[model samples]
Target: MKRFALIFLFTFLLSPKIYSQRCGGGILTFNIYTLNGEDIKEFDYEIFPVSKELLQKNLYEKVVNEQNMNNSDYPLFKSVETSGRIIGKVFVDQIIDNNNPKLNAKLQELLDTSAITQKGTITSTLLFSTRENQSFPIVLKISNGDREVYILGNYFGNCDREASLVWGDKVLKLE
Candidate 1:
């Protein structure tokens, strides 16, 4: 009885840490827009929680293995850590407009079927520019799902070219 109780306690204690080692959770929707407020890209991303194990793996793959550097060398890859433990695998969706009749119809149908309300909601905006010299901003709004929201934005600054959003001492950049 004593051994069984010890094993059970140990297992329970370690379960959360073990499971949180990789990304897995809910879907995050990111709506990307031009600086002029034109919606250009919409993506639904699978959110994952970042752990120390994940950080080590990413550093090894991108830095040590890919760049052929020693572990003691400066990191060649960057990692974003959020106050929350969720990262997303971004999946691009087809661009559509609110003015599009077909899309409007579909949206109305969804609204009719779903009992969605924006009571407890959080929104994060990330502004960035692409290699094409196009400047844009993305708005990420999360509601009625996970308790925490994670969003990262990266881009060169228009004025200084070194400005970045700092959250909890972590610099967020577009992946």
Candidate 2:
């Protein structure tokens, strides 16, 4: 019984560190708001660390599917290229190494809401290429990097569902 208790305690103590190591060096949150500026819902989207190549491939596939290309077209090609440039270029490092033991404290600071919203030293900005009309407005927050950069994006209802980053908070505007 004593041995079992010791093992349990050890696991409990080590789990947080183990879990933190798996973090993809970034976090995203979605906030939903009404037209009147009332917050309706908020949730976290667990973004996985991925290589730039993988992100490009995924973005290409997403554009292809959404455009429903029956034939090769210049417009479609341009759209795909633009989307890749916007998202892929902006995030120079898609998968940050949060597992670095030296950066543990920094990662924790990056994940802190107050630190990000108020005291964050890094300049935060929102960048998106395509604009679409929607019934409701969605807000997305992305936190990443050792120095921590936050990205805010406005998602237009169903149109952005396919392109929106999965690991972050997603706020959907309700009709």
Candidate 3:
């Protein structure tokens, strides 16, 4: 009985650490394009998932409150809450397989083909916070080759218009 108890306790203590390391988060990839469809930049972001406690401690109060108050406006908040599951699918379809039939068809319908080009790789990290009854608030630290851009906003909602860099005074949209 003593040995069995010891074994069970040891396993229980070790399980969380092992599980967190493996399942805490995932990588997200995306392209940056001019409204004209020119893909001038790409990013491979590694997101580290955080617990509710950690999120609250790290994120800004306004960001957290906005997520709680405007839950219905942002679909990406749900993805962030789940630590990028939905966003992962978007990344796969949009960034990994450009020839994916469904996405390609959709893009063809929505965008002009003349301006799109695939190029560049930048690495970055995403940060966020969540409450029990509210959506998550997210921020991105985008590394653009030699420069870094910090984007502050909810995951899928309108990013701060002033937060963008690299476009050199031109207003660009992030799809």
Best by TM-score: 3
Ranking by lDDT: 3, 2, 1
Clashes per model (N, Cα, C within 3 A) = 2, 10, 0
Q: Poorest 10 consecutive residues of model 3 by lDDT?
A: 156-165
Residue 78 of model 3, lDDT score: 44
- Candidate 2 ranges with C-alpha deviation above 4 Å: 1-32, 35-50, 61-114, 117-175
lDDT of 3: 0.35
After the best TM-score superposition of candidate 2, give how far the Cα of residue 51 lies from its true spot, in angstroms: 2.9
Q: Which residue runs does candidate 1 get wrong by more than 4 Å?
A: 1-34, 39-48, 62-120, 124-175
**Candidate lDDT values, in order:** 0.30, 0.33, 0.35
TM-score of 1: 0.22
Per-residue C-alpha lDDT of model 2 across residues 51-143, encoded as one tens digit per residue:
334333544355566545445364544333222112433443443333555444433333342233322222222222222331111112334
Residue-level lDDT tens digits of model 1 in 13-123: 887654322222222222322233433233232212222233445433433564454433332322221111123433111111334465445434432332322122223
Q: Pick the candidate with the highest lDDT.
A: 3
Q: List the residue pairs that clash in candidate 3.
A: none
How many pairs of residues collide in model 3? 0
